[model samples]
Target: MSAMGILSYGLTLCFVLVTFYFLRRTFEEKKPLVFDGYYHPEFKPVADVFRQNLLNGKERGGSFAVFHKGQCVFNMWGGYADNEAVRPWDKSTLTMAFSASKGVAAVIVAKMVDLGYLDYKRPVADYWPEFGQKDKGNITVEMLLSHQAGLPLLDEYLHLRDIVDNPDKVERVLAAQGTVWPAGTDFGYHGVTYGLYVDTLVRKADPKGRDIARFFREEIAGPFELDTFINTPKSEYYRAARLYTQPMWEMLLETLMSTRYFPILGHYILFPDSLLVNVAKAVVEFTKDMSVFNNPDLREVPLTSATVTSTAEGLGKLYGILANGGTAENKVLLNAELVKKLATPLSQGTDSVIKQENSMFGPGTVIMKNPKGQLMFGHSGHGGQVGMADATNKVGFMYITNYISINGLGDDPRYLDLENALYKSLDNHESNIGNQNI
Candidate 1:
């Protein structure tokens, strides 16, 4: 055959194969979207919203939980934990909450503050002397928590083993690093470095030398009986849900379509040395393979910025305490003054890394408003996972999923829909009570 004919044939064959693959995947038979759980009659709208999403194939295996007044008023779980639909998602199912772990770590820090072990306004150098190097003496604890320390990405690459095996070395590397921006003047998301820095801070601040993981396990999880873990145990590995991510083509399409991400893409292309590019490079260096998160070894490591494993009920109940003035079961987990500090905004502006505008951050938590415009505080993870506390209404909400969304730049619509339904239910319940009182 002629060379031109050969090239034409090769291209035609490749197109045929690609088309066939997409067709087969699109037409594959899917299991029924079956869910099981309990919802208070007053919150039936929340349950209905969940069921509709499952039925519409918008959600895979996941769970949702809400705690009001320190009680589990709504809890639900369903679908398959594995891609093959063999293992069912149940009450014990656990999934990686990604950056949502930061919120959990923030709660731990709040408890530390409440116990008088640490102070937000004090310089972080007070706790760890080495951190004062490179003109970081003025960087306060609140600045780090609020991502205003200007230490988002380190000049040197860091390995997970460096943190787990040689923490002192990691601390020294962080200490020697210079700020990317003028400290306390601007803010950026400390994607990979947040946990490394915070873990070191916890170690130095605690009299017992406990890291954030140990502190959370002993001080928060044990006392609260929550299933959340910064450092997951071996026995609980069996309950972990297998994560599924969108295809690269789908991700690229979504990024191009996203109003928020498109501008960031342009900025990255225009300015190679921009903070956004640096943060992206740092994240990529740490997470070479997104699928590595499913490995037991990664989960066992305490990545407080990510890799937190928990069920919906676990996060809901923990944030429930925060929603109800930091007390649960007649025990004070955090004093009212500390809770107020946590909810108060420490920084507000456009996030240099994510390019999100009008973002507000508290001490290690993202501050947002619910549909009703009531202030809510919590941290969202990489995928669609979220755990938030609505102190004004005393509601704690959590949603976890193994199926990762392609929308990386903004709030996932699935979560927003669920949250809107939850608030609507709350409004209806309150209205009914008010009518009864009248």
Candidate 2:
């Protein structure tokens, strides 16, 4: 009876605390950036949708960019990247683009495939023999791209060190992992596994034996003159923008920061096994500044999971090249057929781990499952970073942000509201409201 009373008291206290927390947040004015509806002549309803999004301010200091025929049609970003309401975020401010870097990394594989240097149908072990450990030798490049390789997280018990400490050793250990399921029988997100695969393949394919990050700069960023990085440098480390999850934005970071690596360490916690995490830590330790994580960190690092940065103008510009079938400004990134190849989703069966079917995947892209309506293909990185091209209409758009939304998973009103806006903006009252967000 005594213990029961204690348990009841604890439960009541927990309930009260949770209720109090929710009530406190209910009135918190997160008003940072409201929407400004800019409309194209034919797509006027998008204006109202944009206005609504800005008013909500769920996406802080984020960008919305559009391109038609490889040219910037509309690109805009506003708000505080730091949320002190002090430093005004600008078009030049870059953020860790999460998995959207996969799209950039995929372009290299497409290039290799185009040159006939890599075969999608061939075994990955053909390229890296050591990768054939366990029953994985038969897994093909297409299997990895489709998330059907049966290896999601590394099989070994893992922590931050195993996840972060060393990549080369991690590769050797991972390459030997036994299949969690039969190859090509499931679709599960690769997460860090994708990075390892891309990095190894890139080093093997490139003349300089470089990582995907360096290959991206040379093949994509340098050629297109875009600003971003996969392997960030210590040189431009001081110009980075600080990102917050929520609520903590108003606090002076120095008070809340750890002595070891404050401020910049938050980004590392958010995006694990990423260049942003490493670079942000280095930048914070060396310069003791939060801005180091915001500048271009481009170098010779290979990351398929993170290390992409760009303005809306840059995104629109790259989409233009993609829209033109991989040629921008007379420089061919890849061929038209290869772009179509990228748009095609490899066969993804049932997944044993995540247990979700990847209805859409094209190399590293996430195409609209029903592209018949919009003919859309592009990629989305965590933290709301997105790049897309409408093949049907030849229009492209890129949305960049420094944060991922945890509340966007289901029927939550906030999630519904944001997704509804995207589809409404797409349909102009043409699509069913129920079908809008998906």
Clashing residue pairs found in predicted model 1? none
Counting clashing residue pairs in each candidate, in order, gives 0, 18
Worst 10 residues of 1 by lDDT: 280-289
Write down the lDDT of every candidate, Cα atoms only.
0.84, 0.58
Residue 231's C-alpha lDDT in candidate 1?
A: 63
Q: Report the Cα lDDT for residue 91, model 1.
A: 90
What lDDT is obtained when candidate 1 is compared to the true structure? 0.84
- The residue-by-residue lDDT of candidate 1 on 129-168, one tens digit each, is 9999999999999999999999988787776766687777
Structural RMSD, model 1: 4.9
In model 2, the runs with Cα more than 4 Å from the true position are 1-48, 157-167, 236-239, 246-302, 348-352, 369-372, 407-438
Consecutive 10-residue window with the lowest summed lDDT within model 2: 278-287
lDDT of 1 at 141: 93
Which has the greatest lDDT?
1
